[model samples]
Target chain A: MDNNKLQAKDFITIGIFTALLFVVEFACGILGFIHPYIVASYVIMIPIVGSVPMMLFYTKIEKFGMLSIMSVLLAIIMFVTGMGYLGAPLIIGAGVIADLIAKSGGYKSFKKTVLSHGVFCLWICANYFPVIVTADSYRKNLVDGGYSTEYCDNLFRAINSKTIAVLLILCFVFGVIGAFIGKAVVKKHFEKAGIV
Target chain B: MALKLDPRTKLFMIFIVSAVVMMSATTPLLWAVRITMTMIPIFLLIAEKHYAAALRFIVLYSAALLISFKFLSENSKGFLSAFLVGYCSIIVQFMPAVITAWYVVRTTKIGEFVSAMQKMHVPDGITISLAVVMRFFPTIKEEYSSIRDAMKMRGIMFGGGNVTDVVEYRMIPLLFSCVNIGDELSAAAVTRGLGGKVKRTSVQELKMGGADYMLILMFTAALVFFVVFKYMK
Candidate 1:
């Protein structure tokens, strides 16, 4: 709990939380593979599932830089797994700002945690940025490789249609939703765990 | 040969190569480099005597490429094929990182990794958090299996399972126990003198050597060549 020292348990809490985030992500991946039709569902579930562990993490660490450390670690993992290097910067930046907001509420403000989580959720969409930006090149690669014109155009258009702004707003709405749900779950079930 | 390189260098190179693969518009030369970069992992896995895993990577990568090619060339249109194509491309793009991660994780010892981070002057927050990342997953795996067993005994099958049933019965309890684990682990770490004010030392030898420098130089040259080719062409 001490910001200055950050005993081993604090780091342990951060580590487990990071792994939990990844586990939820892995669960989401399994769902996507099984129900490819529900890829869109992932956009919502990604934040909510991730935030479940994160809300508990925030509740326990209750200090500065814990979220930042966890975010950086998760970002590194995401990058290493080929999600995108873009996630690294986006996560670290969003994490720091989120940490600041949480700090403003003295790390106990549930409202601040919710707002911070909403901001933090934006980074999860970093995986899409490369697809959106390179949609044209991907189209070109397909077309030049003897793909049909319609298929190429349709694929490119599909990716291009979802601009960055649209993605962020979606994350914001869902992030708030996810955070509130996590808060309720934590309060109800994890109460005896003492995090709440 | 890359096995001799420092853990820090492997991590740095992976990040650099992954970013390049993600960002490029795919000129001919870049494609050549991407193919070669993808193969490095396979070779390293082979060197590490992981023959089965290495063969598996080759088969998967080839399969993905074939699938993408087929989808791209298809005249009939639907979101399903398009989605498959998109996903295939993503898999191919991320393959190098995935392979490299596999190699690093399989080859590097935990003590060596911690020492490597210490040598890099990484903050305790990050280093200790990473140590935790290292320990957490295997623990989770054990706990996960037991939870599944418990669910089976209780007749808690999913598919027809209710959402609240999962949230109430499965996730909450799993999270609750994980929290307890975290507390015990942290206490164990503290008693072992982790998070001390003074500098900590480890028995792991993690210094950069000649191979590390050579690999760094080689990657740096390749990067320079890519940049020059990108602009000059």
Candidate 2:
């Protein structure tokens, strides 16, 4: 029972990695302003860029709940940053599913880890929820809120309901690819340093 | 005077501001309410003696507001105008929540935050992880700067012109340091009796005061005013 329980150490690890992941997200998010297509590409950008810290995190995870807690944190942060609560369910859902997948692999199997990561990366799609679910109103809000019509048109073009399915698949595929790259990086650095 | 507020009140302020921020203000009156809501946090920052930050936020926000209102419109075309509009609108749209979040994070100590969370019956896992997250941002910034300095000394500018190198050079070092720091942080936490079986006690007792009540009332009023004016109208 004690072995299964999360400790202070686990919490700190989750906190550190969550912070790192957020930094990566914020950095990539800044570029979306340059072009709407960049916004749609967050799936590719975040998973690959964020995977290094995540893979390192995976190496440290010998228990469950870490990823789930991290997702809950991400949801709260997204809300606090004014991303709205629309995506909160998807974010938390992806986290729990990712946690279960990793657990099923006993947190050691490489195939399970990659698949778990792919599932976890779906949270990136949650950012598109407002755009898809409230398309008309959200577009109206943007135009009313000072965004250019061109920008809105492009945004909706790149990320409407139909394109979202493709984006989710891209996010998962890139997540799997990112996992392998992240594992290599971890092996190249952390494993050599005896930190893993 | 250093007007200390209860963490709960500050959190409520965050909640209200974020909620208001999510919904765009359409009418002038709604905008007025929104601007005023944003100002309260700036004033609170000033009251907290964060003079530099308050002044900086005021300048940036008002400048963005001026540029967006005076210069840009929906019909404004071209890349430069679009770029300016994008930047200005982003600042105008999200700055309020950002400022409020910054104020809350800057003012609230970790112990106070944790105790308040416990008082609210938050799970220990979430609370502890959240507290660490709150404490780790500044540390990351500090570590990042040091890494940048080291890179400069080696003359490894912008990952030697490779995009992957740009990411790899910075990210790998950052990850290593963060992992090490996490270990050290957990050790310190364990030494302090964190995750112990006994129910923990706090050194700083939390109590809501007049300021807390006043701020809560004001924020609630602002939220109510925003919603009613935006939707009911």
Q: Model 1 misses residue B170 by how many Å?
A: 4.0
Q: lDDT per residue, candidate 2, B8-123, as tens digits?
A: 99999989998888787777798899899999999999999999999999999999988887655446577777778777877898999999999999999999999999999999
Clashes of each: 0, 0
TM-score quality measure for candidate 2:
0.97
Query: What C-alpha lDDT values do all the predictions have?
Result: 0.75, 0.90
**Model 2 misses residue B228 by how many Å?**
1.0
Q: Candidate 1's residue-wise lDDT over A108-167, tens digit each?
A: 888998998888787776656665656776566666654556555644454454545766
Considering only N, C-alpha and C atoms within 3 Å, which residue pairs clash in candidate 2?
A: none
lDDT of 1: 0.75
Candidate chain B TM-scores, in order: 0.85, 0.97
Model 1 alpha-carbon miss at residue B111, Å: 1.5
Cα RMSD (angstroms) for every candidate in the order listed = 3.3, 1.4
> Of the candidates shown, which would achieve the greatest TM-score relative to the real structure?
2
Chain B global fold similarity (TM-score) for predicted model 1 against the true chain B = 0.85
